[model samples]
Target: MISGLLTGLSLIIAIGAQNAYVLKIGLHKKYVFPVCTICFLGDFLLIWCGVFGIGAIIQKFPIFLDTFRYGGAAFLFVYGLLSLKNFFKSSGSLVAGNTVSLPSLSKVLLTCLGFTFLNPHVYLDTMILLGSIASAYGEPGKYFFSMGACLGSFLWFYSLGYG
Candidate 1:
């Protein structure tokens, strides 16, 4: 359990679209609970895919991997530049007031889906890497590992949203 938890946390600690979005929503304090819940649920879904042998299908397609990798990298670089631009444009504190106007639940869900699906790393982490690792532990261990992964996602989004 401990190892599984650590593996899950460690795998997701690196910066990515979902994490960036979560942090953004957290700092903005807008639609926080829903946004965070979406993140957690998204993570859970992807982790399940990885743990359930779906990653093997993804692994078989080298061209797909390459395409996704390059595209995701481009998206990250652009997203980073945009963030930096936003940071530089505003003089006021990012923490000062709620800059993010809360949107409707539908919009929030769409945004979460966008944050999740627009990038490929989510698939890589949840399916390729986490799935591979979880499969190593057999059936019961796989479940434990998945539980840990789910918990990690929950904790991370909860912290990002509430902190």
Candidate 2:
């Protein structure tokens, strides 16, 4: 359990796009509760799936992974372009409401989902890698590891969202 807790913390502590988006929404105090809940639940689901050996099934089907990879790439490209356009249109100020309009809750939620689901790294890290590691501990240990990982995810997202 301690090992799992430490490993989970180490893995999720990194500041990635998902973390950044959570922090931004948190700072703005918009949809923080829902966003954080989504992130935590998403991580929990993925980690549990991993612990149950879904990673092996996914590995067996390379085509499924390929499809998602290409789709994720396209989605990321379009999102990047949109972000670039927004950046250019803005006056480049930290002030929230001066020249930039906050996005609608639905838009924000969709974007949050995109950031969460479209990133292949999330699956690789949480599912494949973490799952493999948890497997080394046997059945009961895997559950403990998964719980620790889930706790780590909840703690991290809540901290980022509400801190």
Q: Residue 152's C-alpha lDDT in candidate 1?
A: 87
Give candidates' CA RMSD values in order.
2.6, 1.9
Q: On residues 68-161, what C-alpha lDDT tens digit does candidate 2 reach at each position? A: 6787788888877987897898767543334455589888888888878788777887888888899999978888988888888989999988
Among residues 3 or more apart in sequence or in different chains, the pairs in candidate 2 whose N, CA or C atoms overlap within 3 Å are none
Question: What tens digits encode model 1's per-residue C-alpha lDDT throughout 29-134?
Answer: 7778888887888889988988888866766867777777777777777877977897898775546265646467687678677677657878777877888888
The local distance difference test score of each candidate is: 0.78, 0.82
* Alpha carbon deviation, residue 70, candidate 2 (Å): 1.7
The true-versus-predicted C-alpha distance at residue 69 of model 1, in Å, is 2.1
| TM-score of candidate 1 against the unseen true structure | 0.81
TM, every model: 0.81, 0.90
State the displacement of the C-alpha of residue 32, model 1, in Å, after optimal TM-score superposition: 0.7
